[model samples]
Target chain A: MNGHVYIIGLGPGDQNLLTLEVLSLLPTLTDIVGYGPYVERVEVPNTVRKHGTDNRQELDRAHHALTLAQQGHRVGVVSSGDAGVFAMASAVFEAIDQGDISLKTIQVTVLPGISAMFAAAARLGAPLGHDFCAISLSDNLKPWELILHRLKLAAQADFVIALYNAVSKARPWQLDTAFDLLRKELPTDIPVAFCRAISRKDEHIELTTLKNAKSSMGDMQTLVIIGSRYSRVIQPLSDCNPWFYTPRSITKK
Target chain B: MNGHVYIIGLGPGDQNLLTLEVLSLLPTLTDIVGYGPYVERVEVPNTVRKHGTDNRQELDRAHHALTLAQQGHRVGVVSSGDAGVFAMASAVFEAIDQGDISLKTIQVTVLPGISAMFAAAARLGAPLGHDFCAISLSDNLKPWELILHRLKLAAQADFVIALYNAVSKARPWQLDTAFDLLRKELPTDIPVAFCRAISRKDEHIELTTLKNAKSSMGDMQTLVIIGSRYSRVIQPLSDCNPWFYTPRSITKK
Candidate 1:
């Protein structure tokens, strides 16, 4: 019984965004497990045993996947976006590290996938061409102080930022605070784009400013993209949605 | 005679990373064009006419694709990683601007795909989980001063920085200058991860400090991932490669 684990990235909610690497490995997986809503994105064949739970139940799912893998099951833990980008890859490793699970015996390979930042960037244009970073506003795992420190750092850097887990159920005010801190460092006119439920049936993308993002953004599904000083939003034509771009060259003379 | 343009994203180098969204649209394309090296990553069928050229020839290719599309041909413009992130999508828009191409008549759809940053993040773990930015050190398009300003901003913000086009044939020391500026704002001890030819053969990933990165990097194929103030490089027991992670929670004790 050869037990191996493959941590797969399902991409941002669309089956079409799944990489061929992940798709090719689906058939070989004896068990597919992840956050329930994310696992539902993949159309797993009936042959593979599916194990899914809520987001808070990640540790439980990882333990189960590890147990199954140790018992000779070819397990694949799926995550939305890139599995390693605020996803399940780290949890799996942490779980593996917490115990004496001999990773030497079991093969573990992490397959990369499309992330929400890339999905959102495609819809909005190239606001992220220059320096940028992706930060999660959810305070579930980390302290808000640390998050605030990171936000302040991002603002001072004038780096375009892709914000993940921006506004969630329990953490509604997180984005507002982040926006406030960002506005202090960035210009009030800085361009901000919001992409909600990207690559999904009800996907919505809109452009605004950091000052106005609070009223414009609604829930956790939204990914906020804030541009640096160099990034600007341009409306191609009348009645056209504004697109973001970072000028290739800036002239000082 | 419908002239349509499908802007596709080819995942980081390896064909396996190409998304189903890009894959499903491949069969419908009659003309495929993109940056020379990236277009070679995809397998275009014999029926589809392929056009590939250097980065300098990007505007020409976009014009060619648009002209073909206007002539009632379905054209697909491909780019490595996501189409929007320093890829062909901007060139298409630039060509449209220069030539006054009527986008209203042409059914142009910009589809999302994975980016090199996401690929690098996935391979290296969660160094990018918080606020970050991507900067290109290529002086061909942007002036070195603007790049320095942006680097200064990123450093002040303490955002994780993903550097693209860091080193090339002409601009050898641009990365060194950028790194030096970054050191001014950030502590010299900040961890930096260099990922070369990710998701491809001869892939190399190493963790070092900003001060030591200049000698370690290679040509255009490499991606530099600089950790945030809180990020650290940990030597995981299972793998020889250094792993980076930002703690899920940060406590102010």
Candidate 2:
């Protein structure tokens, strides 16, 4: 009964991106816990118990993990993309701080993985060369005003933006509102790339203009990459699919 | 004698992050060319010829690689991080565009790799959870004025910024100037993370204020991550290392 927890990033919906380090450690785990969809992707051994639920139930899941680890079980709490990036790592810390569970002596390690930003950037040439930012449109925890303010700032700065959790169940209009806010500051012709289910069987990537992106996007599995003023919509000779490139240069000629 | 060139990204220092799809194709190469420092980290077969050089000779190297590939040899032009993101893929494209090389018929494939921003963010917790931007302070390609303008926009928008190629041999003051511009708009207390040689053996990650970062960072290998206004600097209980977390929430409580 080793009492330690390893937080692993499943890496852009693909199992291959899981490091040899993470893969080697998986067998030692007695329990694997994460968001229901994410948990389904992992291949767990017969000895490992699995626990999963919707994203909102993360705190409870984390608390249960801490309790299980306290009882001398080796646990792995997993998340898609790097666990630290918009995943369960911080919530685990917050839960610890809130005194929901007291496992001060427990060993916790955060393993890195390929984020959606990198995966999306790769799928669409190099839209994240010089300066870029990623924002989530879901306003469940924060106010929409703040998201608007950040979007405005990102657009004005001419930063390639990677929008995550762009659309969700309760927040259907959030992505539309974000698109409208960005359209005001950024040129309507700016390239907006939508990469859905990256590195998965249902993978789909499309490059469109910000003006037309709202009508084309839906749900949580999508990631929207808005190119800066310097980003170009290049037509590669190999593929009919439009590719985006953010030049290293900051200024226009 | 099949003439074809494949530009590949080895991914942030670690050989493991290289896609299995890319790794499986490595054995087919006759020659691999890249910057000396970047190529040294890769583990390829002895049958593959290796050509390495400094950064200044990129154009020359691209021409050399194109020549070898045109001579009916399988050539792989290697780059760290994603090949398209500030690497040699564009140089090869530019060389073809210059009409000096008739590689229009030559097959070219740009493979993706993990970028430094993702590796850095994964190491330092989730500063990129919200909207963020990555800007290079290098004045080699653009004027300082444009760099300042982009920085100002990023600051005003409150996007976490990942600054690449921040300091170099000839341009020492560019980073300082960029820092000064950002300091004016962002609070002095905002957390700034300096990650050097990420995923490499000599990696160093430190958390400090934006005001103090200029003096602490080194040359080209460093990546300066400036957290947005929403980013919080928290000391993770596992290690003394300070982690930065950008909340998904728009409003600060």
Number of the predicted model whose TM-score against the real structure is largest: 2
lDDT of 1 by residue, B1-253 (tens): 5478888887778878888878889888898888777767667678988888887777788888988988999999998887877777777766655566364355567877778887888787667655567787776776677678767767665667888887777778777877777777887888888888888898888788876867346677888888777776655555346567554445556
Q: Which stretches of candidate 1 lie over 4 Å from their true place?
A: A97-106, A183-190, A229-242, B97-105, B182-191, B209-211, B232-242
Candidate 2 CAPRI category = acceptable
In candidate 1, position B92 carries an lDDT of: 74
> Model 2, range B17-77, lDDT digits (tens) per residue?
6666567767889998899987776678898898998886766787888889779998888
Which residue runs of candidate 2 sit more than 4 Å off their true CA positions?
Answer: A100-105, A250-253, B1-5, B57-73, B89-107, B236-240, B250-253
- Could you say which candidate leads in DockQ? 1
lDDT of predicted model 1? 0.76
Q: Interface Cα RMSD for all candidates?
A: 3.1, 3.0
Candidate 1's TM-score: 0.88
